[model samples]
Target: MKHLFSVLCISAGSILSLSAQQTQKPILYGRNWMAITGKPLAATAGAMTFQKGGNAVDAACAMLAATCTMWDTLSWGGETQALIYNPKTKKVIAINAMGVAPTGATIEFFKSKGYNFPPEYGPLAATTPGTPGGLIYMLVNYGKLSLKQVLEPAMKMAAGYPIEAQAANSIEKGKEHINQWPYSKKVFLTHPGEKREAPEAGEIFVQKDLLATLTKMVEAESKALKQGKTRKEALMAAYDRFYKGDIAKEFVRGAQEQGGLITMKDLANWKPLQEEPLQVNYKGIDVFKLQQWTQGPVMLQALNILENFDLKGMGYNSPKYIHTLYQAMNLSFADRDFYYGDPTTMPKGPIQGLLSKDYAKERAKLIQYDKNNTNIGPGNPYPFEGKTNPYLNLLQQRGYEMDTTKRNFAPKHDLGKINTSSDDVYQERLLLGTTSIEAADKEGWVVSVTPSGGWLPACIAGETGIGMSQRMQSFVLDSALNPFNVLAPGKRPRVTLSPSMALKDGKPFLASAVQGGDTQDQNLLQFFLNVTEFGMNVQQATEAANINTNQLWLSLGGTKTEDRMPKPGQILLNNNTPSATREALQEMGYILSFGARTSGPINAIYFDWKHGSLWGGSSNHGEDYGIGW
Candidate 1:
């Protein structure tokens, strides 16, 4: 009887443990994954291929190619960046397809033109285009399907497909820019009369030029291999066909006449930046990121800081949690401003402080109990081993609030709800919310990049596709402060495209990228918190309602800096948000910014081992859909 009792106890314990594990398992699974994008037709087609047993790479290739036809703003001539994780090799790879300034372009040239470099000058300040070369690299290296096979879906979509609501909406928002390009306008717009235009919704949009481009890409490998060239040689030959051959020469000549800077040599010398992936650890999980030239590292640094906190105890979307997040954001942005640049050019600066575990902990210490603290300072990296300055002392002083007996973890107050508007920022309070994670692996890595040109040269003026990047405008132009961000040739700009990833048990579990210019870090930080600390599923994490703090934008880059913290403590909120949340946020000392039209789409994917499947979601705000089979 004693032995039997012992056996029953042991059995009960085992059952309880298994049940706990099962509860923790993430819902949604598939060996293969599909995601819907803001661009529905493109996402739908990609989903179809996944249903046909294609991998992420194959799906990505098809989606990207198809997007050129569907999304005029995002095209083949634009840059491409991705971070990929390979489960087989337990590694991550980073790819930089960001374009560079042309050799002859000078700051003096723009100054001479009496232009102070606006935020987005597209064709006028164009750099070398990189997507075509990028596609070749992704297909030949990471993908399982042949170029032709991956491209089949894209070609079909280009030939004819009903325009999705999201795609149509995007086109409507960017219609002026689309119409600005004569070739683009001819292919996409339906300007039937003075005030009337063809409806993009449910209409068939064709891209004969893009289809021709894809056809050529497919032929290059086949024709070159027939001539006995190696794969690398054949690929290079294809690249030439893009930028140095007949199509390229015409493009260059047309662009030159329109005051564009790209030269034959710039195209010839242009090559994607390839390097090993950047990595850090969080709660025994290895977090991987791209280097600093893009803002991927910024997200990694923010996550590193949050790790020192008992974030789970803070509860989801609580006022305390959100406020603390904003504080951390301020600290991260401060570090980003002081450091974080092209490592080769800047060399051993403040960025090290940004990502150091000790520094992150110290910074985490600054979170306060009840006030909105935007003036947070930076934490030193080299201080005392095993821990950093701010967090350790702060945690000690705060008395480990995570201890259940001392405090309740749920949100204390209901601010109203989060809302949106197109005119200006509105403040509302609601609940808390959160891409696809960029994948890292043996074959190659995918990187998330936001390569924007503030000053675009006119493509219609025969500038071909050449345009200056508007990224420089992200820097503060004020001579009194932020002298480093002053516009100059070869000066990398401050950015918010925070591409980020996470690892579980030292292996890659999630990799995602985002493209919101001002909202990037805020979105990434919250999304990651949902997955790691809040214990939410990938879809839940991605779908959570998130607020944009815009630390750098508020302090340095936005249209109204002074109005960020409104007078009399009244803040604007997204009109779509609940009034109660807005009132609460205002009472708490926040000013709101609102806009119905949002920034770039946020994209993400995660692997759930418990269910033995993958889960993915795109921005609900975007017209794009998330697809998985």
Candidate 2:
């Protein structure tokens, strides 16, 4: 452990060194392909698939499966959103596998229960599980591997594996909550009723129920294949068993038996969708993200606004650059809070207008070069789309109006001023995370996925070791808060899990993703700029100093008026930031806090089209890793 830490310091220094040096975890270089994710073993799962002659999609599915089993801040019941670059069609396609509010999830129901929003924990917080079906969907449609084959590494680990300190400590931290659910107690607690109930670091943690669950799915696939079903058909059979067969029965029975809203029909009704992703041209690169149902558009929106400026000329992380970036993000998130939501349902926001370059230009004009704009609200995009804004009155009721007269949301000197303890809870929710998967092969297939939900202290359904997603907390109960995003039965919440991909000269350029809720896009936006504007290599960009804004409404956790409220003018800066830059930001009406590692721990694959090689980057912030061959 001591040696690893020493090497890590060197790795971190290697990236920051002006002179050419080796990174702590060096950039992955491969002529054929590369795979990267949140855990070393999980990346190896993708590598195993690649070695088995799998395409990027197949390798990605394998990586997601491994991460879920290993609890890389997510699990099987979580949601998955992916952007795949199909070399054949030369088009980017989106996979939206986010689960919806289950039956009895109406706002009135929650309000009657004396809740501000959905409960933050337990069965009540769950949506239907989506990852299982999502994994099957991606494999059947875009992959050339069988469900049984893809799940091999995950199944092996599910049986038993030496648990890492991070996951073990998470179980320890969340043990109080885990104790609430009997099944979770059985799976996560290796020494229940002891001083430290959760497994110790490096303990061989085992989950027989989860292993059985995985075996059942593989069994279903095997049976279907033996009965003369095709590979895709067999995969669907496994999906059916999970959502409609015995597994579904047990999951529903277990959840409802414990207080969840999911019904068997809800499970059966939910299915993954394939759609066109949202895209914006930054200079000449075409960047793509999941559509309006997610916070993804926020990144594209910010990019459009930044496109109007000569970002390169401002210099990197300069006072002027940071100020412009912060303001643009606030502007984008203002629209996200008011307008972005489940576009598949009634009263969709002006998505067409929101993404319009002209609309972005109009919004960009609102930025003040000298100071931060704490009072910025959603801009009018109706004119650009040629449609009258239907809910103009609704827009006025934004629940996050700045109250400078009240305590400062982010006081400089006394950073621990308002909402002290509650601030930590709010930050956790705002940054409730997900694990990312990035895979690419020489065959031109590339996959970027951000899979989340069902982290530790997660409620496990009976008999099945699967964790239920707490994604229901992302919903808004009041239409006035966000008409398009207000909680309703069968409606998907606007999610924070976003994966990114970019194409240059009509070919894949970069595939990147990270696991910080609101900060996902913030970090990604800067990473893109680090490469495009500052000319940092992919590895440097992944480890680059970046800032985060708490100016957006919280997407996860909390249940009161103040809980989801915005923290205007509050920004998190890296501790290593120049004191001058910090002072410059504070003068611009910004309250600054600091962290050693600020980026998303972003993992990415940059297509070195020039050299005909693939360059991989896994950030130094966390345990994220990458492998290439």
Candidate 3:
């Protein structure tokens, strides 16, 4: 009887494992791709478009439109940086819709206002919004479906849709912010006398104004078409409705009343800056990225640095793996702070010399296996700078260096000084001890991004709930010498948004971006390492144990990380991390602090031409969902 019971138990275990495997369902379709976002409805919308015979670009358009109404963190009012891989042309094109400083913005004007860069320099700090322009560009250049058709899903959702877990959470958390703006509050809040009546987990919230805005856009497009205007011309007319017509006027009035500096000219004169995407060749794969304004180069530098070592040998999620990745991130961030900026405005090559292949190789040589305290600034590899290919360097070179100089890793100051109290040496030792790290598997797609402009106080005031751009908050106020980065008009703030893409066998595979302030790169790096090096599926890759070492300390989250998280410094390890690995890290003199770290939600679409599939992944930490059919 005992023997029979043991056999039955083993059989049951086998059946359970098989069930788990089967539950890991695959989204399959012909002439159909799959996409996953943080929102199920949004994913369904994209899938519906795919089912309607729209290609990737069309699906992208439809999904984005829906997201504008469905997700508050993303909207038509925001900006976008995208990379579209067109197999037909055998080329990858990038679109940077990142806004620019208004024409009237100037350092001198800001100085005269008796304000240093305070993270909220009013309208003078607001850049010309480029999202609408960028979408228009995508529709004009890449979209096959008419603008009307592409916007249908978003319009439908905007008209009315049930709020799901993600949307409800956003509403609940952003209550203060939503209530602050009359229009915003109207769209999100339940009704009069119901200040806290947020939608339940599966209730409904409607954005009537957004729906109305969409209606106006559709009408504007119709009017333009009747006048025999081109599609681009029609879109431009719609843009004017928001920027030059009543919307623009209202926004301007609000800014003026609120002591903000936005003007009608700022909106009317706004244009998307056309530039080339930066590219790098890593291990026979061509990686492409947006320029400095988004911090895309740092990833290229880090990957290049990693290429020098055999990461596979280090073992997945081991102390060695985490150590190497953190070191690479720290080094790349150092370069990001010091030399990265709008290249066009800077001399022909500010850090062009630093991002070269030779420089990356040289930087990679500095990775010490055992030593901690190994800090090096960026190196200028002048001779290896590549040709400028649609790359727009959008940072002010004069003040750019100042921001970099004051960065926490700039040799003198201790990163721990700002937040964690552990000494630098102690932190390094602690890092060496923590283990059980796993890399995301490279399923069918890859994402690389460099989203920038987070310098001072997150400016968000006036103009239909428009807040000041987060770029203004990049500075730390009381610096005795070289005290800049205080939110100032015309002063472009520091940014960490890096536009990114991955390639396999010299072909473009994935293009993506995320919105974490500083942790974007860390997230992307981990994902990239997981997929390409560790070989995990997309979901597992995204869900794997991940640690974010933004500066000196590390925070864990995700499938693997979350389990052991909430474990404080010196807390017991109740995780699958190998005892050997933990011992190794502890031996390195590290103190473990288990908690959640924010690495803004990541977004990307992958093209697996060989398999005739395209896959996309969105951030688990965000309200966005991944949908692909």
Candidate 4:
């Protein structure tokens, strides 16, 4: 494996000045290809694929597979979402690899069981695994390599890889849950019996069960090829082995034993959707994301609202700038909470109205420049369609009342004197257990993907080494009022796994993604603005201080009584942000919480139009790494 600091340094006489390196965040520069991922090993896997003549899609799949093994918070059985930009077609494709509820899942099912909402963990929360199917789909349709070839690296890592400190910490946090399930304990703990604990960082952690499972699929593919099946046919056979063959049987048996609802039919019928990407034009640059099912559209709506402001004049991370950004996010998130859902169940209004420039102009008027507004709510988007949201009253009734005083905003990290002892002043660093990868080849093909689920608190299938996803928890149980995200069989719960792509002058310009659940789109928007509006390179943009609003509806299941509103005058800022700016914001009536960390580790690759080279950047805040050659 390649070292994290290893880079193919370009010669001194390049378009970019070498002197600037000392001042700016380090960025990996390469003439042919680049891969930025959540882990150095994963990036190295992708780079190896690229070196072996694979395209960007192939490299991305390889990297994602390796990431699933190395990142304890991610699993092969989790959900995967991606956006692929093919320069040859001048188009971007959205891959909705998120899983849906089983046929047995329904509001009444949970109601009869005396549950208000779906469980946050265990087999009951599991949806059909989509990552495997999604990976196979990408490989068969767009990749230049076989499934066996791409999965080899992942199998090797799963057998025994050097554990990192973060992964060990995550394992420790979920130790109790893993201990309850024998399969999970066997795979994640240093010992399955008493004295079990998270392995030490740099210790060789072996996942023999996971390796056996992956090897089985590879063998299945090889058997199909030996039987005279075509490459695509062999790939499909291997995919079926996970969803419709022995793996599916094991999942069904485990769920049945554990009182869960998933069945073989659900797995057999599941298929990842390939759809047109939702897009909005910003300053002549086209930004694309997944559909309304995700919080992706919130970023677009916020961008539309922000376009009306001269953000550059406000200064980056300045009080006014941050305020404006948060306000836009608040409005968009308000709308998202009230309306965003699966396309099949979305309200009557066309989604286009939400993205329209005209609607953005109207919504922009809600921004109050002189003071912060805490009582902001979703606008009348239906008015544009000559209708009203009939369920608005029910939404308001169910909404958690805004109580800023009760909201918590303390730093989770113990940053010496900056840390506070007050419970309300402290906040937990939210880890959603997700990973992202970006790959770009010399051919101009770019791929960005976010894979999640089956992390800590996940239920491992019986002897399969597959951790089931808890994505079903994203759905609301209200059958009457929660029309969009209401629990239903065959319905995909609204998710936060958003991957993004951007184009400039009809050419591929950017591919980026982050792993911060509800904060994914919010942080991604900041990165985009840092580059487009502030003229920062990939590295500088990634390393910049980021802010997240708690005012939006919580995506994960948590205490129902907690206030779901953004604390009035309260925003989170990393300690790296200037103290002067923090004081200014505090004086402006904005409560500030300082932490030593950013919202997420955003991995991205930028296509330098002038230089015709790829510049890649990854966050140093986490295990992220960037490699190019």
Candidate 5:
């Protein structure tokens, strides 16, 4: 019997190669340390603070204080932005711990109260929270721990834990604004007798006034390390008991009982700055980000106009590599909406001619490749800095038209069936709310933060459970073509919390992040071109299938007809892509829609360096995790 049909065809080809390696989604190995967050108990409290030795900035500020007590759509009176790196000062930095505006938040005090925009939630969209002075300034400069031991796992999970189901559906969609604020309905609802709801997801969700305001800043850094002081003067006496004592007079009495404009000298002239990180390079890696008040140089000007094309011979997520990455993310978000802002009030030829490379080779000769174009704009990076396009006479005195047959639009706010852990209707339509974290170790160190504004136009400041940041609803009240994101008074607002890192030939190599809001660097530039041009691995480059560019321009803050363009042949994609690349991007004219999980989960790691190993991943789309051995 011819050797019994070659042993049953080699045992049916080893059971179809072990069922295609058990349907492919593994990639999470580790050797020394790793962490990917957006919950799973804050990536097991950053792999138990790197197995108790703590490094990658004290396991990313102990997984950002255990994701501010297991995520309530990212808070602890939100705002964090990181990058870190520092393999013994081979340097990287850029923390910024974003949060400013409120020297009495101007713009003529919300246009003399007529308020065209910038009051998304309350206390005049509060600021000055700065995630506990940017997590105690990364635990008193590159942590070793102690801010009472990296906030003892967020004060033991805010004294309780258990609340999940997407943070009990964002406290049941901010339960009517936490029943109109009685200290945000006694710390985010769950009464019992007066029958309040939301706290079900396996119950137990306590807050005990955010563990008594993180136990009064860990007993003001353990009474200044028992009067002996010195762990940087006991973390500056717990950062002057949260910005100049008594939690800055309870954030100026919850911004003067809600008609807010923060003070106590805007929480004693807030801090968290530290700079140096807007890098670029690409292919050979480098990357970094945060500066130009973030929209992070629209992924290094869309990876310098997709490095003059040929994206791995146009394949991965092909449709001519997602229409040349939607024409280099609509020409790097039309130069990030006419030159990004707040580099000290914009305009010095917008970030040296929108991060030149001969202005990205003249914006990569206006990307074409078989058309799907949308009459993109914002270029003339100030004629490569020799000046002029100073917002071209305010985009022709604000006419800034487009039309392109009304770009075939939608999303004027549907938030595509919510729950990517609450951006409460995109922060009550002021847009961009986020969450992210990434870490690495084995001493080569790495980081990638991204916490975000307090949840959906949140407020809570008084009793100190602390949930302020409506990141001043991302500024802009259009003081003439939005100066560089207008509305000042202690400036800073022009955020969309971007957090990425990379390096490769020089070390680190990838540390990604995400949480939409103008699709955070278009989902970290399609997960860094799906791991540098389709090699795919941080879990198949964040589980592949992406695409976003609803024709750029919308970094949130409104007026100019609630700006955020995207219509000229719309393009969301993502419903598990590939139906022949969605009919080749609808035969290259674009228009598609598909929705749900619109490319914003990510949370990466990578490293590898010839098998030194790390490799992590996340993106199951939402309650992401991805820990490591």
Candidate 6:
């Protein structure tokens, strides 16, 4: 019933509310530019950059810095993966800023420690810091503003900013772990010996070490500029200092002293790569994602699988529609867990075959219309790539998927199949979150980035004020699980921070992303279908109720075999979902759990070429917000 068009804003009161559906927040319309992010303050940073005549890239970089500095579920040392639509080239470029596994990170090493995967937290779980280098790489190549301009908001926040309740609460929740690392304790615990160790809500929390680190980078850039270096060269000078100079030295020393494995060589050798992205055409629109190193392509694969079905005819959130979506997602994630990994590493997943339409049709055949397929596993995509299946023996050795009944108790009858408190610890890893950045301007530039890692409980490097990334936990320790993703030194993990882009009729159509780790692509896949197949506007699509399939190996958190295992037949749905739909899912083998908000804060922008304006959207899930003018 929501094919109604939306007029432009994020506040209440809508012109369409009288005759059509009403959304909690109104659409944000911008004639010149639009900036939407996970936090209102970060979005303000993007707006400030745009106001300074900076392009979308510059605004996005500023927001990235601000979100990291504010610790918006992420810190300055996390990974940054993005998709940029450059008006000049009229092509989408992928930025792979994900950090690589440091020295001593190997499957044998982790297994020797009596672990099935890398530890979930602490310095031992970190990779070489990637966010600072990533931010600089993006700013140098495509952004118009100087590093000083882009970092202003974040630097100010680092110096001293009023902390929000959400962040303060997170610090309190993680105080125990924060105390484990001296540097982290120094920065986060304002009242270490008191009952309330973390800062109170709205307190002017400051990070002097972080401020000094940021100032050092700025000083490096300023020195280069004064020496007659070009803007590009000056930016790279800052990048060098972070990765190869004093910053790198301090970061490596701090990490190693705290039992981390990162070496100065690892930091110096690691560099963010700018490469071509993979894409698929769905109903005439081209959807793009980063390479196999990320879980981004999973959305492209699901879109391909869903293309065979007439989604609109089944209707939105219909039982039949939900079933079909779950089935398609199931098939896609099966391949993702088994095959998706770093292409630069040996035993790389069959990237070409995985995205093939022909391959998708074959996978779709396994979807049973009547019952859930708990035994669903990876399909043979090698044949589609015109290669022999060398891992056939391994595939044959592994049979079926879920087997959690013995280790973990089932969810209560009232709660449905969604995992309950019994698996709360596991649930945290499956949904480890990140912040997203979506920026667009009238100049035809667009940037969609999903930056994560170095979350709360992170190990702060000494003097650097940088939190080491906990992304190493995303890697697999066995080839039998994911040959392409076997943990190794310098290899990137298959992360779930997926940013999205779409071009319709050879023009930029949409830029979208979400924050929930493994749920990022799943929510994004449906968010796109909401707009393209169901005709919902950007705002409505973002605010739309979505279902999450917990049928894949989680990309973050968890170390034991049982922790990484999937909860097949479990489904998470919006609380407002009709009883009939819930019953139908139960009948079809789904264990249904409900929540007021199932989505992980989807933020997006729809390029309204007809009106020559931008339409932005933020979900009702949490604190996500957007501004346009």
Pairs that clash in candidate 4: 410-425, 551-566, 569-591
Question: Higher-lDDT candidate among 1 and 6?
Answer: 6
Q: Residues 516-547, candidate 3: write the lDDT tens digits.
A: 54556666677677667765544444444566
All candidates: TM-score: 0.76, 0.94, 0.76, 0.89, 0.35, 0.94
Q: Residue 538 in candidate 4 has what lDDT?
A: 84
On lDDT, the leading prediction is: 2
Report per-prediction Cα RMSD to one decimal. 10.0, 6.2, 9.8, 7.9, 22.0, 5.8
- lDDT tens digits, residues 29-132, model 4? 98888988888889999988888889999999999899888756678778988999876787899888888899788888877876666777888788888899
Superposition error at 488 for model 4 (Å): 1.3
Instruction: Quote the RMSD, in angstroms, for model 5.
Output: 22.0
Mind giving the per-residue lDDT tens digits that candidate 6 earns over 1-629?
Answer: 11111110111221123225677899999999899999988999999999999999999999999999888489988889889999999999999999999998878888989988899889989988888988999999898989999999989988899998998999999998999999999999998899999999899989898888888889999999999999999999999989999988999999989999999899889999998999999999999999988888889999999999877766778777888899899889888988888998787788899999999998787777777877677778888989987876666545432332231332221112346433566556667788889999888989999998898877899988899899998888877787888888999988888899999999999899998878889899989998898778988888888998888777777677777677888888999987766766777778877777776689999988888889999998878889889
lDDT of 3 at 37: 46
As a whole number from 0 to 100, the lDDT of residue 432 in candidate 5 is 54
Q: TM-score of the candidate numbered 4?
A: 0.89
Least well predicted 10-residue stretch by lDDT in candidate 1: 427-436
State the lDDT of candidate 5 residue by residue for 409-470, as single tens digits: 33232112212233333333322547788887787778888887777426687888777877
**TM-score comparison, 4 vs 6, better candidate:** 6
Model 4 spans > 4 angstroms off: 1-25, 112-114, 192-196, 345-350, 385-388, 395-431, 479-482, 559-568, 576-580
All models: lDDT? 0.53, 0.86, 0.52, 0.77, 0.72, 0.85
- Summarize candidate 2's per-residue lDDT along 505-541 as a digit string, tens digits: 9999889999888899999999998888877888988
